[model samples]
Target: MAAKVLVAYGSTNGSTARIARTVAETLRRDGIEAEALPAPSVAAVTPFDAVVVGGGLYAGRWHKDARRFVRRHRRSLAGRPLWFFSSGPLDGSASERDIPPVAAVRRMMTRLDVTGHATFGGRLEEGAKGRVARMIVHSGKGGDFRDFPAIEAWADRIAKELDNRSGGGSR
Candidate 1:
């Protein structure tokens, strides 16, 4: 059977959503059925064979909606391959500093029995909405730090993994 993948994200300034769409597109290009949807739209997850959940980091925490989505559907998620990612790094510095995964996410990842998790740099604009965002932007650590090549590479890995999992490719 062709593997169907769902790429869902919680985004504040649209960066994570764009990343999710790109990942979905990459999977589709590789002949997989994939869709990118906001976390809120995914009322259920059983339709997809695999899932990639991501969200923007805010004040050192993931968007509440993303966490809640996982919490709401963790039972179903456990029966499938699942991956998590966090996007929030200002201008490469956060990545360069070797920032660790969010504390809550680390615990959740263990409990969810997810396949894997990754972290990526994020984009920031000067006038980004929200008080915390504004303060961070005004602090002079703002720019498009996202690395497309890395994101694409990650997607490729995911596609290959899904292919292997679906019994469609030789490992």
Candidate 2:
């Protein structure tokens, strides 16, 4: 049977959710069975052979439910094929090195021995964010800065990995 992969995400204004859907679609296109689900909607991790957890970053932190879901399932996930992604750095100038710090989530991920982690750019609206979030958005630092090519490339890599593990040749 094909290895099942689940892509779960948390989004504030929907950009992250869209990215998760793209990743899931990419996996499916590679002939991998994948499902994209909202974080709160995932009742169990037992069904999937691999997991991809995605979340939006806000004020330098990943969404609360995303963190909680990982923490709750960390044990079941430890031996599984696992990947993580966060979207929030909205500026073209932002890099993994230059993006805002997310110390707490980083520590949690390190503890979980996360297999892979990706950071994607996010979108921001003028009035939706709170004062501080709005300031960050308007600080010449926010836009629809997501890189779709990079996202697809990463998803391809994950599909390859799952294919190898499932004794399937690369497409």
Candidate 3:
């Protein structure tokens, strides 16, 4: 059987959603059947052979919904192959200085037994959020620094791992 992959993401302003969709699309191109859905939309985990959980970072934290989703499915997640990613650190300072979100993701991955975790640069738009969110966006450097090539490469790695787990490529 072909491997089933779930690309679950949480986004407050939609950037992370785009990243998740791109990953699912890349996986599909690699011959895996993948589904990209918001974390809240994921009602069941039994159908997927592998899971990729992603979220956006805000104020040095991930979307609460995404964290809850993983925590809720902790046991199932521990048994199945899993990957975690967060889209943030567009300014590079966070990545350079070791931000809290990165640390939090590492802790969560260790606790959940995820196979891997990655951080990707995220975008910031002017006038696209509320006062606080806008302030957070503004206080940090603004830019669309996401690296599509890196994203695709990461997705390819996930596809390969799933292929190996499923006894080489297609089922």
Alpha-carbon RMSD, each predicted model? 1.8, 2.4, 2.8
Best to worst by TM-score, what's the order? 1, 3, 2
Candidate 2 ranges with C-alpha deviation above 4 Å: 94-101, 126-129, 137-140
Worst 10 residues of 2 by lDDT: 92-101
lDDT of 1 by residue, 8-115 (tens): 899988888888988899889888899999999898999999999998998889988789889998899887888888898876754455555699888888898878
TM-score against native, each model: 0.92, 0.87, 0.88
Better of 1 and 3 by TM-score: 1
Candidate 2 per-residue lDDT over residues 42-105, each given as its tens digit:
8899999999999899877898878888878888888898888889877764344445337876
Local lDDT at 119 for model 2: 84
- Compose the digit string of candidate 3's lDDT tens values, residues 45-135: 8889889999898777888878988888887787889998888776765345433346777788888778987788887777656576687
TM-score of 1: 0.92
RMSD of 3: 2.8
- The lDDT of model 1 is 0.85
Model 2 pairs in collision:
none
- lDDT accuracy of residue 146 in candidate 3: 74
